[model samples]
Target chain A: MEDTAVLSEIESGQERIDLIRKDFPILDQSVRGHTLAYLDNAATTQKPRVVIEAIKRYYEKDNSNVHRGIHELSNRATAAYENARVRAASFINAGSSKEIIFTRGTTEGINLVASSWGRKNLKSGDVILLSEMEHHSNMVPWQLLAEATGADICYIPVTGREGLLDLSGLDDLLSERVRILSLIHISNSLGTINPVTEICRKAKEKGIVTLVDAAQTVGHQPLDVQEIQCDFLAFSGHKMCGPTGIGVLYGREQLLEAMPPYQGGGEMISNVEYHQSRWNEIPHKFEAGTPNMAGAVGLYTAMDYLDKLGRDWIDEADRELADYAVNRLKELPELEILGPPTGRAGIVSFLIKNVHAHDIVTLTDRCGIALRGGHHCNQPLMRKLGVESTARASFSFYNTTQEIDRLVEALKEIQKFFNQ
Target chain B: MFDDIDDLYQQVILDHNKSPRNFRVIEDADYVAKGHNPLCGDEVEVYLKMDGDRIEDLSFQGSGCAISKASASLMTTLVKGKSVEEAKQLFAEFREMATTGNIPDGGLGKLEALAGVYQFPARVKCAVLAWHAMAERLNGSEESISTES
Candidate 1:
């Protein structure tokens, strides 16, 4: 009972909630003259005032090209940029700041690994194992790599009956020839939090490197690279309340040291001559040219906002909201929730039986309720679930139980309209 | 806000969607085409039964949003027994009505209710998916069949 009380306190940290919400001024606004629900958090979250101000501050005061100039602004810019790297390292519990390389977003991060590590390690007969629930960002890159490197791509099927990654199939698929096991930490479409630790452990036993695409999981849950023991993890800052065009690629220091640099540019090189040049070490080697300085500052501020909120508090809130939404939505006869009803991370994908997803979205929008409708960038998973499209409502900590009630009410109206 | 969606999803449109006129496979179809909106995965297959200048029968099949379904239903009702030249003229009028947000002076016939759809920019494709497919079929461009949004 004491443990339960402590859990409740951790879940409902009032001070933290007020502090975090205060920083995000956009939360107070209304849409179409109604209070904005902002349920499309998985696509890209709204930035807080702190993150917005950080971008403004960088442009106003610390604006300069990093790593090249000898002037004061340049030095400040470089320090601010590297400071973000340190923050990113601590955010994911990476060994060193050198392991955190900034890229455009998760898409670029996966591509970097596919081109650099994949090009070197994968051979003609080798296999690359990926989950059936992978986003197109994860799937397409491997497919392109496999085509170029003569490697075979294998999938761990979901089957939809269990709505979990097929661990039994993982045992059968993992072998000496399987070079890398790339999977999403949490499904963007289905919201299934995969058992990455177990998958990583099994892959390690088979002497394979693992890459966890935590695009949807990182900010929603506490993640430690050391605890998971995955070789690499990637996530986009934009999805976690930061600005676009800045994301983190967390790689093991040793592994990052070995892989070839992705792009050739000014800051990434050690020394340049007329003929050839040597590349810089780890993070810098991969981060080519002028980085997204404003974007990095925004991410830093966003991380600071999350940290102040206390990660556990946000996680619990999101989980409770998701549970409430699932339970309420299930009450509608026409609404069919996809994937495992429970164990889902703050997302619900469902189809209104007779109503087309696009129509549902359109009608919902008319009611000032925004949601994502389509394949959610996982066409293969859509096929697996025997659905062409679905309406997805992904929540964040800012989402409230009242919002879930609104969603449920909206869904019932949709069903009734279609039935009539 | 939604006391009843039947106002937007009119009874006539629902009736047309349920039992769409000209919904069948044309056996001796001169031109056949399919249109798709990749963004929404809405598809429509149009089969035209042409007897020289006059359209003997026109039919369509596929799946899509209510707008597309209703538009296809309306299209069949408009062109079922019309001449090829008359059908082309209707297509032009329909296109103008959808794109320009201005209904022609003489009422839109059965298609008047759909004028509200132009207010929704994203749904214009849903209204035009079948019409575009019909145009592709009329042009005898079977290979050029495509979905538009």
Candidate 2:
């Protein structure tokens, strides 16, 4: 969480982290009679007391179906919900609040673009360029679109060790037929940060609409949708320590205005007739029936929290943690790390020989350390990497070095158990 | 947390996981089925060489967590000499043992090591993936088995 009031707290570093850890009461508990070492931040982050309390306050005091009720509670809910939209837009440094449309989460946000913009523009044989490292949320919707429209799909292959996108063949791929380029800002599994500006700039020049799936990066780093210059951006609040069922889709004003409505429902329409209805303006047009009001309250607080803590601080901490994790994990001859150590983010994916990812995860659970073990919803990437699955330990700023050590110790124990 | 790691990854289980028994294609196999545990990305191809009602030979090949590989390995050894009817009964008992934590009585000797998996419900699928595939193969089902989460 970033905050100006937490200047001293941000500058304090480790001592600050010690205090910060206390904010999340869930961290204090034990999972299996051992202290919980939550390393699954990419999957979902634990909520701090302040964020939780905000949701509780909203439900208790300001709970109402947003946007239609004329009562005081409705006004409060609408205010909170609209304020959240403003906060979400500002969080990404979007051009305007109207650019920010609330959806269930990143998946829904992406589906909105694929179904609405994709359906309207993409024709049979037109190409949608994607990166090899995109999450299924970003890929599958387009796949379904391709099935419906017969729009061809191509990928920017992952280059060398760090799993960076191979832009060498990008020119060949970005021909006249390429209509849209939807790519991941930071790979959820590999932790490689893609060059969004360069990629988006290229696609923009080609008149291809650009969408960035910022699900993994928005929470951990400073985001500027204007700087990225993508037509659309999608991310989940839950990934950023906010509640689930709340997410943001930042589309360019003109693009959102031009695109058809994603879902037909009450709030999305300006006026409903028996058979025909006029759609509402940009952001509201995208948001369907009763939005997650409590989620908006909690998400606003979460963004406030992250801003207070500072993005630079979180990024530095995660980089250090990932480097430490990669370096420490690399010491074992039996283990092989997935991405390069140099500039990768907080996530570290690795494999121990002859050990199934599930085995490691299951065994680690007993030790009270949560590590993800699977394809990580990047099944195609997994297949490309020549492994079925990998064990991933993704860190958040609230996580400490001591926790990483705990994960390391637990992993060693797992190895010894299997090795012996 | 529920049980000792040793209880789940027993010496016998570890041994099978390390050197899975009959981990190869049974040439001219009467039945073949593929199993996938999508959650763990475990894939097992179970092959059977049946002689009339008897399982003349049984084998499997797969890569997975120790639990999955070990389960498939142990299954091959146990089912190799049993008749098709006996194998079916054994599988029923295996499923019963996996679903309920009660190590079912009578005749499921080495297979009982998988009892530790019951405590961790997620791993129960891992333990049963191969069995599900083999059951499908034996029953001549058209669909490939998938243990999805």
Candidate 3:
């Protein structure tokens, strides 16, 4: 555990990856008589053993309803849960744990914000600015909010297949009538890394509230709420080597305090009467029911494991795999890549002429290479790119260049099978 | 690879997908219906010209995956000159084959190429998308059908 030993271990990347690979038990298996090469990280990540153990340890030892009973088990459960909140707050460099609210994942976090803050602030004439490449989770909540509040929803257009934002008219779009600017930090399908810090700064200067959907960026890269300076940020735990049914929503303290509670129930109330109830503080007010305590514990361990692996290293490793996959896929003449040629993240979306994405996915699955196909919940973006669907290969830090090679070979065999 | 995937993407299916029959719009079609699978973004438009109780001509045009496209192409040829009642029976049989993996009494002929779709629960909808549209049209319903619904 010496600093020099750790430095040397990280210096040898392959050895470190081998060690990391052993931490995920699911990866050591075979699928369809071939070694599994999982390239579907964009959908969800395989959990590490430590995270799994953390959840088990919580349920076995400290299982109790948090902030309730006067017993020791309840005290232990409350401590673990609050400690997870502290970890989440620190993981994103938020001002305090009070600003971190746990929810069912990124989808629920967005809905909570839309229902609570959006309903309270938006007026009929106001505009909610979004981007064209947003996932359905980020778009649908705002659409519902707009419908209820009579607000107009506008989009920052995407520029063709590259999936970069067309910000030429951003100033005009950020007019006085615009109330909020919500966008993704990194596109899940296209691997486009949006300049969220700069975008948040621009929105801040225009006095518009900003929310960054960090669902795809948080685990792969270093995230600091102070650096991004956004009013709100949302991310899922399952996408980051943690358990499902838990996520963090980091909001500015003032904004969270001013917003009304998203739901009404037991734990979120300070004083309850037959007809009226006083709400609790910032985060507790939004958490209306019994929270996912085990999920929170698993997320805390996952975050710790990720920090140990180092964000800078994970980011570099992911980008390297994506670039390698993109280069190898380019060898096929009919393949057309979607996303930036350079500076793309770990995701690579592509289409082959005369070969459907579903076919590619099904064929590649035969070779034990998993890939995502279809709109990836960005149907509007898919239509904008003039494709019904695209095959996507997303990577994580545990993925190696050899896995990318297997993917390339599988894709070649699929092309040949289709006589392309 | 071919051996492993042949059952799902049979040679007949690939042939139809590559060069789909009746892949054009019929301007004077008596019935037209669009089929969509919003989950995967697969869409197909079925065009039919019926002579009383029998289908006089059938065609289709759309963009979708190979399974959906091939299924649509085969559907156009299978039910082209068949009577409305016979086509409905075939539709029911096709649905049965796709969901239960049980071929009809004498087998489904060219449509049997899609019988393997029963192995893939996620792709059964792809195999039946065009059939659903055609059935809706034959039943005199002009509404667009979605496999998701």
Please report the candidate that would top DockQ against the real structure.
Answer: 3
What does candidate 3 score in Cα RMSD to the true structure? 1.8
lDDT (10s digit) by residue, model 1, range A1-420: 111112224444555455445556787877666777778888988887778888998999999999878999999999999999999999989989998999999999999999999998888999999989999999999999999999999999896834688777677899777999999998888889899998899899888999999999877888899999999999999988899999999999899989998999888999999999999988899988899988898899888777766688678888888888889888989678887867889888888877888888877876667888888898878878778788899998877777888888888887777666
Model 3 residue runs over 4 Å out of place are A1-11
Query: What TM-score do all the candidates reach, one by one?
Result: 0.93, 0.97, 0.98
lDDT winner among the candidates?
3
- For A68-129, candidate 2 gives per-residue lDDT tens digits of 78999999899999999999988999989999999899999999999999999999999999
Assess each model's interface with DockQ, reporting 2 decimals per model. Answer: 0.58, 0.64, 0.78
lDDT of 3 at A61: 97
**Could you give candidate 3's per-residue lDDT for residues A179-275 as a string of tens digits?**
9999999999999999999989999999999999999998899999999999999999999999999999999999998999999997999999999
Error of 1 at A28 (Å): 2.2
Candidate 2 local lDDT, B1-149, one digit each (tens)? 33466668888888998888899997798888899887866688999898888889989987888888888988998888898778888888998887786766574798888877788887899888998888877887857799872
Q: For candidate 1, please provide the TM-score of chain A on its own.
A: 0.95
